[model samples]
Target: MPLTARHPARGLLDATQDDLGCGWAWDQVHNVTPRADLSCTYCQHRMHAKRSVAGLRYFAHDPGGPQCSLGLETMEHRLLKLQLATAIRGAGHQADLEVRGPEGRWRADVLATTGSGRRMAWEAQMSSITADDARRRTATLAADCVVVCWVFVEGHRPWMPYVPAIRVRPPADRADPWRVITGLFRWTGLHWEPVQVLLDDFVAWTLNEQVVPRRFSPPRDYWVGGWTAPQYLAQAARRRL
Candidate 1:
């Protein structure tokens, strides 16, 4: 049998003081002493702080301790979900963080309901997930009229050949909405900025099989302006020069 290794660090529900008793609270994680007041949020084991070279802090269990799935989340995953929830609510939609769907069949990192009755499930995928797993999750959510969108948090290295690109499948309610949407989350010092593009003119650019966008930058703030598929190809080609 192949040996398996446990994940080093994972995301906390909220690093804020509200979760102070959780032991790995943002404030307590920076302290020099190990906290005995709280237990692991997932497993009831005691956790100790592990600081990185960059001074970023996370929690870890003692040797021979059992592993935790919830503790396998990265800090990026936590922050992105929080920010997305806040942004969704700010956009005048009803946003709920870490909400469970009907019968607890599914859980969305950030579930937002638009004023016009559109329910969107935003998933910030920072870890590796199989194609089958992705399809299964999507199918389950779709059954409940929930549109699930996977957002990659790879930060702005779109120039890399292996970066992920997604095809836009219009909502079932729409009529032949042939738009291609592609993008990723970029870390801008303090927060992650979502760079997404939905282009109807992708057919012309798709002809050049080598073209792929590394980042999506709108002309102005928000998803405004006319971003054509050709423009993205042009920008990508120039960077290769």
Candidate 2:
């Protein structure tokens, strides 16, 4: 399931808009006109509008559509990506879904862009991945000068401290907000400590430069650990600069 679909003429249709319609209405797209010609942005498979029991809106591949990697995406992954896009847009940035690098070098679940032209990729990595694999992916983005933030909404986050990432406690209800459990920290005069914050605020502050990534290199002073590299450096001197 994906929240975005490519319209032959309209270009891209965002299913998350709560309004009854986008440039096209929900009634026109959802089960009414199967000929609307909406297709998956990732796989080009035909897609149709779908709503969850809780009223979350997104697109699902039409029946008989070929198997696409995006079709394997879970509801958890879809929701997290949706939330990331919403937060990015709420902060006045452009949030392009399923954005890919040239020649498939990399892909971002939600690619955010600042008015100043800075770019960051927000990835909702719900599946289990080895730390080495995570580092390799992060390094790929780094080589392209593309900043990436890996967000884990479930499972053990063994790679959180190793990369510029964060672990969020999923809300019990879909309408509830996600809470940051780890990977965001503020420095005291002497050491680092976890910072409790909502996911929306974190994204907003980060895009606005209220927070930045910091590596506790030697990390011994913080007693955090080796292999524990990039983490958040929350508001203060950096914001002043």
Instruction: Report per-prediction Cα RMSD to one decimal.
Output: 15.2, 4.7
lDDT of 1 by residue, 1-241 (tens): 0001112353333331234223344554445465434345446565655555644444556556577654667755655555555456545566655566887788786677876787877666666666556667776887999866565543432322222333343424434432334443334444434544332233222222222334344543222111224445464446656
Candidate 2 lDDT, 1-241, residue by residue in tens = 8878888777888776644224677777777734678898778988878888877788889889888877788988888898888899899998888877878888888888999998899989977888777788888888888888888875677776667788788789867898777767765645567776899988998787776665543533221211121233333335435
Candidate 2: residue 97 lDDT (0-100): 82
Off by over 4 Å in 1: 1-66, 155-181, 184-241
Model 2 misplaced stretches (Cα beyond 4 Å)? 18-22, 218-241
For candidate 1, the TM-score is: 0.43
Q: Which residue pairs show collisions in model 2?
A: none
Model 2 RMSD in Å is 4.7
TM-score of each: 0.43, 0.84
When summed lDDT is taken over every stretch of 10 residues in candidate 2, the lowest stretch is 221-230
lDDT of 1: 0.48
